[model samples]
Target: MKFALVLVVIIGVVSLVSTILVANRVEAEYSKSVKRNLTNLTLMYVLLFLVLSVGIVWYIVGVR
Candidate 1:
């Protein structure tokens, strides 16, 4: 569980950094529609990470 939590955090951070990079690149090189889609996808990934983190914390607390 500790490992899972750490992994999730690392992945979340990496995803966030990548999203920022991609967003900047897309905005500069692509259309508004593409940027909008990318924004939505990034939001989904952020929400997923948040939910997973919460679940892991809840599990860890309940076990104790």
Candidate 2:
């Protein structure tokens, strides 16, 4: 679980950096760029849920 959390943190940090780069380069409509940034942020949410689901499965099997 600890390792999984660390992985999520790393993913989040990478996402933040990518967002910075994206914002710096794409100077189009602010609304569209904001939408793009949000879409990227969803990746972090996906990562968190994937880790949580895996941990739940692991607990079910290991603690059984």
RMSD each, Å = 2.3, 4.3
lDDT of 2: 0.73
Q: Candidate 1 on 11-48: residue-level lDDT in tens?
A: 88898788777767754557677778777888898789
- TM-score of the candidate numbered 2? 0.49
Task: Give me the runs in candidate 1 sitting further than 4 Å from their true place.
Answer: 1-3, 27-29
Estimate, for each residue in 1-64, the C-alpha lDDT of model 2 and write its tens digit: 6687679768777877777676667656686867776677767667776887797788878987
Give candidate 1's whole-model lDDT: 0.79
Task: Tell how far residue 62 is off in model 1, in angstroms.
Answer: 2.1
lDDT of 2 at 44: 64
Q: Which 10-residue span in candidate 2 carries the lowest summed lDDT?
A: 20-29
Model 2 residue runs over 4 Å out of place are 1-29
